[model samples]
Target: MPSPAFTDIQLPAPVLKGRGAIGASDNRYELLSRVALDDGWSQEEQPPPRTEVSFDTSKSIIVQQTALDLPFRQSLNIYRGCEHGCAYCFARPTHAYWGLAPGLDFETKLIAKPDAPRLLTEALRKKSYKVAPLAIGTNTDPYQPIERSLGLMRQVLEVLRDFQHPVGITTKAALITRDLDILAPMAAQNLVRVAISVTTLDRDLARLLEPRAPTPARRIEAIRQLSDAGVPVAVFASPMIPGLNDHELEAILEAAAQAGARTASAILIRLPMEVAPLMEAWLREHRPQRAERVLSLIRQCREGQLYKAKPGERFRGTGPVADMIGQRLRLARTRYGLAAPAWELDCTRFAPPPTLGDQFTLFS
Candidate 1:
């Protein structure tokens, strides 16, 4: 066979509107390396990739959490990828498992588990199943944009309600309010508590940081609505990007508290795997002036790297900068009256739904 000559033809990627990632780089697991370069051709900016959803027929929905550092013992994610294209999303790296680019594909190409409700019911029905607060939205937002049409989250919530199982939900979408009919009753029995993540109060910054997520004001309103409905609402000021929205931490907590958040928590920004380069590119494109400083500070917190997967250090970084951020959060928590004891969901109320065969037992 003759060796074929390859022509060098490089083209620039089109600018996608309403997306956080600057480029759709190849996943880490790819065997081949590919890069794009400007070929001097005039290419107009392209529209954002259309959202696509594929089904995941996993047999189990509940994931047993073995990590002791995490608060929940079990968790469920109704979707594999989130449409809310937050540039700093730690979960973006998970898309690589499907051999997809963790940048754009993580947001544009989604996986939906329509069987989640049934799987959750089956898991809860297991004889060896123990009652514990099951978490939702741990990896991806349960109420992401797709949920509005799929209603899978609502179905899951319905299953939990039927079994009287306790659940802890974390979300950045206001769509959660649509399920107030289900959640309010669960809250009445102390079976549910919700955490609304509000990353930044600045609308413009939030738009750039979390491109498809609900606005900060909308999320705060969701907290208020949930609180007024007698549901315990926690404000999650997560991914506190240093040299960027870190300055808005106090304001975010304050606004959330004022809007009736009973508790507040914060996590320092995490840039693991493919997320590091995506975030770096996003910074250079959106906030060019402060991109270098932001990255430098992130490195300082991560112990001279973009990220460190150590459990304790990953959530809240180390070093003086990390210490200061923690201190500020503590002070703000106390100041905003968010130092209240954590709301514990009732686990004793869990009971498996009666099976079809169990109907005969009603007469007994």
Candidate 2:
């Protein structure tokens, strides 16, 4: 059993607790320390510390191909690390590649690709480049809070509009509604679709687990707005942790079905690498009473491990508990009148935006 007070843990409390990860350690070493409140300490005497976010402009924006067997062929990550620090996010360990702590740093220290639009246009304009529905916001939420000011997602949409290319978006933020001007027309042309992830409908629980994400109501509204706009919309009740939000599986699907969502999907929670310790800490702090049971259920799905690395098996685990969850999802979808039929965007309509030299060709 992995406990929060495990001796090998190192990261600081402020950096990890309630923030996706629990501590920071590099390939080199991890800092281990004991954090205890003094006998004289009082709630009146002090308050919690805040972790400010910082961003960086990354050089590369799109990954040409994915090693994973996802539905899509290519994936673009507009941002590295996420502001909506969901405690069970599988992407947290990716921060370790940059020599940063996967816990707090994975959520607070973010990296954005401001150059994505230009690079995407460049890639699309290539005569040899093939067209496929490019998946956006796969690694991090492209419409996160910072996007209000950055407007990078809107810019990316503009580029896709210029080329009349196909795209599929996934997000938890209601902010996608702000881009209907671009998405609506694209939808009419069969050039765009969206999937909104609703983790749990409980407002209080969402606040504790997903500190910076939009409220569940807001995300549900996003599905409504998108579906109303002629855009194909789907719901993802993802990272369904046991003893936590798993009980709401049917309700989430039913609500999405009522909200005009065309289809629904789900995945079991994954706590790979640094994410395990971090999520364990979150359990201990937020739901200590059910912490052990939660971990036990997770283990039941994960083959008695924190998580398994196998490809297809990892998304939906094996064993009776996992099987029951899968069966329940199918039954709920059927009961709610949900069907995940293919919503393929037209690829034949693609055309490269004319270049400066093409202006002269027009006169000729």
- TM-scores vs. true structure, each candidate: 0.95, 0.88
Q: Kindly list the per-residue Cα lDDT of model 2 for residues 219-245, writing each as its tens digit.
A: 999999998988889899997898899
lDDT of each: 0.90, 0.83
lDDT of 1 by residue, 1-364 (tens): 9533333555544447788888787889999967765555576865657999999989888888888679988899999989999989999999999988998899999999989988888888888988899999999999999898999999999999999999999999999999999999999999999999999999999888898999999999999999999999999999899999899999999999999999899999999888998899988888989999999999999989999989767899999999999999999999999999898888888877677767555454
- Model 1 earns a TM-score of 0.95
Total clashes for model 2 = 1
For candidate 1, the per-residue lDDT at 223 reads 97
Output the worst ten-in-a-row residue range by lDDT, candidate 2: 40-49
The candidate 1 region of ten consecutive residues with least summed lDDT is 3-12
Candidate 2 regions exceeding 4 Å error are 1-12, 15-59, 66-68, 360-364
